[model samples]
Target chain A: MTGAPMPRLPTGIAWLDRLTHGGIPARRLTVLLGQAGAGKTLLSCQIAAARARVEGAGTVFAALEEPPADIIRNAAGFTWDLAALAGEHFHPLDLRPDPDMVFAGDFDLRGMLATLSAKARQTGAGLVVLDGLDTVLGWLASPARRSAELARIGRWLEEEGLTAIVTAKAERHGGPADALGPLEFAVSLVVALERREESGGTLRALRITKSRGSAHSSSAHPLFFSHNGLEPLMWPGGDAPPASQERVGSGMARLDALLGGGYLRGSTALLSGPPGTGKSTLAALFAASICAGGGRAVHVAFDEGPEQSIRNMRSVGIDLAAHRASGALRLIGLQPGRDGPEQLLSEILAAVETQDATALVVDPVSSLMRGGVADLGQSAVRRLVEEARARGMTAVLTSLVEIGEDPASGTLSAVSTIADAWIALGYAERGGERNRTLSIVKARGSAHSNQTREFVMSSEGCTLADVYTAGGAVLLGTARMEREAEERRLETLAALDHQRRLRALEAQLTEAELRQRRSALESEAARAELALLEAAEAERRAAQAERQARTAASRSADTPAEEGASA
Target chain B: MSAAAVALFVAGGAPRSAAALRNLTAAIAATGRPEGTFRVEVIDVLREPGRALEAGLLATPSLALTAPHGRRRWFVGEFDQPELLAGWLGDVLDGEPP
Candidate 1:
């Protein structure tokens, strides 16, 4: 367990070896433990082939449960040339127990160990694997016997300077150590493989339960074994990618404003809403915007198939299909009951790696929880967001609030908590009309509009518009229209009244002007008549004067005579 | 040499085993044979354990290749890689299958 770090023996699966800090330390006993169907035997063969091909190390594999032919045949399926590598660098020994063989008194793995040892020595093998040692170990009567036998095997392997990998079935319900018991302590490394339920299927993961000589990742990293081989799913360094200061637009311009520009690049946003409340539409819009900006995006749909999703989003003015065709976007659909959560995460990672995706959309993360692994679903989603953000990609996820459930709580509620920004969409009814409304519940590291704005969905896309709350209540749809109509009516009435008053004032002004003009005319008329009369009078007077003068002269003559008479 | 057909039976417990079938068939097909010259069948032993037992398949991913010349080859474990399976098949018939 101690010494200068043993020489690293790479497992040939890059991620697996990386997590192990290097493969099993050379010439040390390493135990690979998993359930009955965890593919331990296949892994053993892969190890043999890898050691033979990569390190050019002489290897020997002892199959305890499977026949050598089956091992060779199955190895071929993985493209391993086990047979050719054998007789020179690789030696495979079949150790299936015979049904006819009668056990004499005390049956132990001594005979098996002897055969394995002889084969290793004969081939000068540096690496050896005992596939299905649990079956042999299980035959032992007691834990003590198991411990002794494991110690004996460990010592022998060490003495021969040969690295040995032993496969064992994990206990159904116990600590990881239960599968190996004392043997777990005997081995220098213990790798446990398990299958976990995802959305519609199962995912395989591996954990380094123990590794003596090197620091190894103890996390249960997702495992992939194809015709290829076994490896972990975790990104190296086991952390999210570095955050970027740049911001990317969410398709809707108004929504971008609500989000303080747009979602920050490499940030995670959760859009939670009731069904038919445009949750998916928002995610699609984000993806479409990314695609439009010449950035690649990946959309994983759980509620519908890619075709249906594409059609549905297209109807909302988000042309996901076009982006998909142009290779700027990838659309993946998972059936809740048909695909596991781990499987979903792996495909997401594949998209990120293969396409160098800068944006990801998982519509209705709630559907993934239908697999009943709510916690696992959250973890998987968190990892997806982390990986996307780590690579400076923006991830927009949607979760549907089931009917009658609180809009804020769902299977992926944790997503809202982990997301850098959270947006909630819901239906608001006012005066018998239902309209969608969006609220920015939380936006980390940025100022965001907290007002509940009206959300409109159309073939042109989604937009957030001002909501009228003039009446001490938020108005939407028909109610707002009605209020607007009423205001217009009042405005028209007031304008008419204003016009009536203006006309009356104009009439009064005209009348006053007429009165004043008439008065002046009357006065002028009077003056003119007076002047004419005066002139006439004067003429009369003058005429009279002339007559009077004449008469006066005559009167004077008459008056003078009368006056002389009166005097 | 005569034509041969291979049947691979596996338990559904291991997801990798199913993936292995694809590689197994690809190898058998890579022998320069005409289409339909040989057939490879995959049987999920979990669903048809009775049939698997009748065929004497003892483990998951058991393969039994039966040639028209009364030649039968059986193997166990992961043999999805082509080199060894093809080598064994070539050596068994000494050439191409009919």
Candidate 2:
């Protein structure tokens, strides 16, 4: 088989296809191993349905364990339309042995192979599914014989150029052995589906244990089974289109500032919050913004009916009626338990395509967990977000975090990891009032605000108030108002005190000026008095000198004796 | 020796099958049985390849014997091991009347 071109068939599940590197090898025996209720039957049925419907290949599904009716019913639950599939050349064969023939002389692999070959020939089937091969193995005597027979069956199918899929139980004891008998070595590919318990609910996982002649993912990926069928819960990584360096509004300018000019175009944002914290309102605002900008949007209302959702949004002054009427917005309402998660996702995707949506909002994605398959909900949300991003659409998903639950490890944590931005909304109880707060937990590719802003849902739509932190606590609503009022009061008191000090300083300056003026007047008066005294003294001295001059004259007349005294 | 049945198969146009057929014929002749005591049938799988599966033959120059005493044995390989083939045939016919 070396150097020969290997052909592969798609299993129709996106993540599974990616895991198997396009799909299981064509024209080869593939073994599907799983425990009871691990979804092997459903997976096999999905493959057969895919080959028949998608590839236009004739498929013959031979049911060995479950009755054909049950298989058909299950397929119907996924909306596969098995009857229509049969009309289009898909055949379902009941290969279970008759009760009388169970103890008959002989019933072996040869007989089963011959029957299968005949059926394939009659239906011109290119693909064959042997469901419950372990059930057929039970009729055989020994493991060695079963292995040999399986090897022969593999050869026969190869010789006929028919692709074969066989399902075997992976039980430990009392039932089918874990050893897949010869199928483990005989088949070209081996896939396993498993389920385990988690904190939320059961987590289904799918793994490709063996794929000969092709590379495949070896890690166990979460598996989801819903109305669409079985699929790996992992996002198919590259299905989205290329991203553009475009930015869209998040409806609120302050929120946009918090999100670094709003979420990137073709990016996903996760809004996690407690119930009644305006998560849906934020999503509605995001969607309405896109629609108002003349772009299409899809709003998947999980918690409320369409009318109620529209009414609720309208209450916040987000009128979606115009956009809905103009075909710019699509509102899809799904009752959680009525339709499975996969169905809801598909419908949303369909609406996205139909509306050519540039934005998508799944209001309260937590409702996707209603079916109790935790991994399914997680995977579905992840896929929705990724797909929307890939198509260059902004996707905003909301999740309701319960009170007292850590938002970091809540039900939405797994989904939050893939979001381009995570906006955590919650209520702050301050000043005996409850108000919503919005905080950016993480935003990739942008510098976003770290402060928690007060998220207000008003008649004019949702808006973010200025960040308010008081006493080392982020406050909201009445607490924020109270803090602001207190700040203003303090500022007013400081201003009043500053004015009083200025007046006191001014009075002291006035007092000092008065004292300086008085001292100058006193000094001027003293100088004036001294000058007057000096003047009088000068006049006296002059009078005295004149009088002395007269005396000296007289004395000079009597001079001789007076001159000696004057000298 | 009692009557024994043997068959030799060779692909019609294969060089190895022709050489193997010649070696197998010589080994059968060396079995030392009288002409009428044993019968050797030659089948060309190319001309009648469907018969190969019926005879449980998987390759060219395969030989099988149905001994008169109800023993069945099959030998498969290249004609390069003709002596081993002859020895096996001798043991199969050892107790048969001649």
Candidate 3:
């Protein structure tokens, strides 16, 4: 093999194909290893059916453990119509061993191999699935014989140029080496399916453990079983979706203003608070706003049913039921403890895709971590947020923080780190009442307010009120109202005091003016008295001169002398 | 038609197939049954692979016995122990009416 790339047969599953780089290597043997009920058989059948249906390639499906009828019946549960292609394009071989089979001497699988080769030639099958090889290997009586038979089968497959999938049970102890034996060394690729019980439900994961020529994803991808088939939840690999600059409303204008003009489109917002802090209410409002704008939204309620959520949101004036009725909003209710995080994430993503929604709300996302592994829950949430962002869908997740617990330190921390905006709702107890308070902890790519506003919910909807700070104490509820009233009263009294001081100053000015007028009148009287006295004195002097008329010559001489003295 | 039918499946001219055929003939002779009582047929799997598959043959050099009532018994391998093969054939033949 001169370093030529191996051709691939696409599995028709997007995520699985991506996981395998292109798909399982074509015309090569691929071994599927898993424990019982690990979905090995289903996966093998799916591949076979997909090859037949999608590529129109003939396929041979041989069931050694399960009867061919049972396999076909089980496959019918999915959307694949295997019955139509049963005879012409798809050949099912029943190779289940007889229960009473006796081995008298040495034997080999040559007969079965020859039969398979003949069948392949007849149907022109490019792919063959040997399900439950472990069951067949159990009959070989010795490990050496099993190995020989497996090697023979591998040779036969290669000689026939058939792309084969051989499924075997993984041993409980040791590793694939123990169960797979010689088959492990023969196949070009080995895919492992794992089913583990986490919390209350089972989680299925698929990993490509060995790929001889291809660069495949090493991480185990979560598997989801839907109506169509097994779908692997691809991790948000590669570069993140391009950041969006558009803004989306938070339904309430005040809250939007607090958030610096609502949330950024394609960004994730985490609403964390204790119980009854209106986290769900805020999430519902956000979803309702999206739907009200003629856009689709998916609200996944982990804590409550759809009806209960709708009924509860009604009290806050958010009519989610109407949006749901209008087909703009899809309300999905899931019990957190009933399923693992992967299942929840799958359902959420499915809903978003089916609804073509632009906004997603996982109300009380913290519930996912309650009874599950913390790391799995965190990854699931991260994947969900990343996927939503990749599709330019705004995601609003709510986390319930215990009262008095720091939201930044515990389970919410993981989610908060990924959230584009984090709104922490809290209770401020003052004046014998606990009032809801909401503060923006962080909002990336936008200028947000740092104030902790009082969050109020009424029949109208959710609103943010400016919190009052009096004497260095944050006042809320009746305390703020009382403080406001007291300040108004003080203002009124100060106004009256100013009026009184003005009147007193006016009185003082009038008194000063009256006193000046009195003084002027007194000066006028004094001047008049002086004039009268002078006139009287002149008249007396004249009279005396007249009396001295007899001495007129002397008066005339005195007057002539006074006149000469004046000159 | 014989009351009982026996088949010896073999891969063409393999030693095991020859030995199994020889052992089957000897076992039938040791049963002391009349010639017309049992019908023996030799099938080469290489020549007739479809018949081998129809017979549910996983290995070559196998023996199959069918009584008149449609009861069948399959024994695998080359039948190295002749006496054991004879005893098994005798028991199977005894189940049929003489």
RMSD of each: 17.6, 13.5, 9.9
Q: Which candidate ranks first by DockQ, i.e. highest?
A: 3
Give the Cα lDDT of each candidate.
Answer: 0.72, 0.74, 0.80
lDDT of 2 by residue, B45-87 (tens): 6466445535534334556667887655655544566676677
Q: For model 3, what is the alpha-carbon lDDT of residue A31?
A: 84
Give interface RMSD, every candidate, in order.
15.4, 14.5, 3.1
Candidate 3 global Cα RMSD? 9.9
Clashes of each: 31, 4, 0
Candidate 1, superposed: residue stretches over 4 Å from native: A1-23, A42-61, A68-127, A134-162, A170-181, A193-238, A339-356, A390-392, A466-567, B1-98
lDDT, model 2: 0.74
Winner on DockQ between 2 and 3 is: 3
Q: Model 2's DockQ?
A: 0.02
Name the runs in model 2 displaced over 4 angstroms. A1-6, A102-115, A173-180, A195-202, A214-218, A236-243, A252-261, A272-278, A293-296, A301-304, A325-358, A366-383, A399-416, A424-441, A447-567, B1-98
Q: What class would a CAPRI assessor give candidate 1's docking?
A: incorrect
What is the TM-score (0 to 1) of candidate 1? 0.59
Give the clashing pairs for model 3.
none
Candidate 1 vs candidate 2: the lDDT winner is 2
Give the per-residue lDDT digits (tens) of candidate 2, residues A4-105. Answer: 646877876566677777877787888888788888888877777776667777778887778888887877856566767874666877766433221211
| Structural RMSD, model 1 | 17.6
Tens digit per residue, CA lDDT, model 3, A1-567: 428777887876556666777777777778888888888888887877777677788878887889888887877856677777688777889888766555676666677666677778778888888888777666566777777777777787667787788888887521364535665556788888888877545777887888887666667777767645676554524467688888899988998887778999999999999899999999999999999998899999986799999999999899999999999999998998777776677677778888999999998888766665666677678877777888899999999889878756877998999889999998988767999989999999889988788889999878887677878777788887887889899999999999999999999999999999999999999999999999999998887666555454755654533322332
